[model samples]
Target chain A: MSMIGDIARLPAGVPETAARPQVSVATAEDYVALLKPRVMSLVVFTALVGLMAAPGPIHPVLAFTALLCIAVGAGASGALNMWYDADIDALMTRTAGRPIPRRRIAPGEALGFGITLAGFAVVVLGLLVSWLAAALLAFTILFYVVVYTMWLKRSTPQNIVIGGAAGALPPVIGWAAVTGSITLEPLLLFLIIFVWTPPHFWALALIRTEDYARAGVPMLPVVAGAAATRRQIMIYSLLLIPVGASPWLFGYAGLVYGLTALVAGALMLAFAWRVWTRTEGKAATTAARQMFIYSILYLFGLFAVLLVESIAGRVVG
Target chain B: MDNKPDPTELTEEQKRSRRSRSIAIAMVLGVLVVLFYFVTLVKGPAVLNRPL
Candidate 1:
């Protein structure tokens, strides 16, 4: 059925604006923006590490397909998140310029787009790769959209803490794609990302407390205040040090990864310490922002080290 | 004479966006087809024998 025809058939008592066909001026780029490409890139990178690190070899085509499916799945969840959060998104300065908040895409259109891509990604993964991986991808999308976005985000300060699991699942899903099974190593990767999330996000939340407050989001800094959030960041950063080093300790990775994790993790703890100490004025915000930036580099560094070591081990052996 | 814009008529920007979205969909479909073809080539006749 034509969109115009559907609009024309609107029942009586419907608003006149609802009856009029709203022509979207959204371009392909707007749709891509809905995917949250930066987030997808991180998901792709982590999943790639998991895929390459798995025991045995995966065909190049299948490996590419697995990563593609995982990326699309992550993007789909992001689109749905934007669709649901359009109201709060408009309120926050940080998210105010997003496609939906800016009115470049309609909420319903984003919903449909997200659902379509999600189904496509899951089915493709299941068909071309392993069903276990497909199931994990489906669960990740559902967990992010339903459990995190719809349920927890507005309700609690620990939302990101629990929601981090969804983000952390990609590497596990990647491993399942390669081995068709779960193991300790992938779970270790999951643990690293899971623990890494709260401190990383809480740092941003510290700087953007006003934004979260304005949007009524219960971010840790907004709800518990910066001091408490800083303490939590310290705790998580301390925990992440041990979790990040597990792959090497467990003997899956070599000395290089072990050394990299220890040094990088200590640096992360130092940044978190700075965030913990500087709790007032411009110095505080600066500290939080620096930690936030370093958190990204710390994760990328650890995962990049793992990827390099995995590849090197494969080549040398 | 009424100066109101027609609800049925799309503005130039809307037309361009619609065209862009259409092309993106076409490209995605094309990629899916090629992907399936490659998977078939990799799996050979066993492509049909999918295990749960």
Candidate 2:
């Protein structure tokens, strides 16, 4: 299989501003877009759950500061990703309207913004929370920008598989921020997200195979063929079922969370099963799209269950 | 930076947007500066005064 290896420069669609600079200044909204707010929201929600689930008390102000730092760190990684992927962003329909691709912001400006935010987030987290959490935050930013975006994203089909670690780290970082420690519970949460990523992403990759192919990104479907991608999704779904239930099994959560995980994991399997079994055109596309949408809901539901159960336990006990 | 100028330049609307964004950035940075001072005050110099 041919992997989309690293390119010194994008194959096509280098922005026109590269040759003759346009005096286009970015709006506040464009700067917001640079943060990829949707992705950041999910990060924030999961981190909040992690914070809430941890067995300790935290000052409300310090908790807020830690969350702010985490959110900013996630945004910084996003901005850096946009800065690096400007060429590819322009080539892909999904990303064509991004601030950089749309030429609303200069690439250099994004680079500076990202670096500054990244530094500020790390320093603030270290100062306000624990240096341990700050270090994890720094690593998450580095892993996303350097390990994933700059290296793995273009180099291999396993890019997201490995890159998923950065996303998975938020819960663990949140836990550490409050307790100044690491325990098995937060690691279990991390495992659930880590295992969940491939199936969730591969479904979308199946739908956007052509987009990845056009952008020269070696996504699973583009590189391994849709059948293999489907199989991988099923395999990961199976893995996710077990891992998602681990928290309840380990006694950190109650019956409600366990039951939620079981039902949600089964729903995810059903979606992946549809994607896997259907090999034709529109049906397969629809299945993949269903899986893509449901995956987001599944994650949110699982975390929300944990969050609610944690709060209920505290109130009742 | 691209040395060559483009035929297209910022319109009045875009220029206004730029000014607004610049101000927003400035205000945010200013808030962050104040936040840093608050954080430092909360932390205090107790750790510095501690015996090594």
Top DockQ hit: 1
* Number of the top-ranking candidate, with lDDT as the measure: 1
**Candidate 2 Cα errors over 4 Å, as ranges:** A1-23, B1-11, B33-52
Instruction: State the lDDT at A49 in candidate 1.
Output: 98
List the global CA lDDT of all models.
0.94, 0.88
**Candidate 1, residues A1-317: lDDT per residue as tens digits?**
14677866777888655556677888999999999999999999999999999988888999999999999999999999999999999999999999998989989999999999999999999999999999999999999999999999999999999999999999999999999999999999999999999999999999889999999999998888888898999999999998999999999888999999999999999999999888889999999999999999999999999999988877887
**lDDT score, candidate 1:** 0.94
Q: Model 2 compared with the native: what TM-score?
A: 0.88
Residue-level lDDT of model 2, residues A42-92, one tens digit each, is 999999999889888876767888899999999999999999999999999
Q: What is the lDDT of candidate 2?
A: 0.88
Model 2 chain A lDDT-worst window of ten: A1-10
> How is the predicted docking of candidate 1 categorized under the CAPRI scheme?
medium
Prediction-by-prediction clash tally = 0, 0
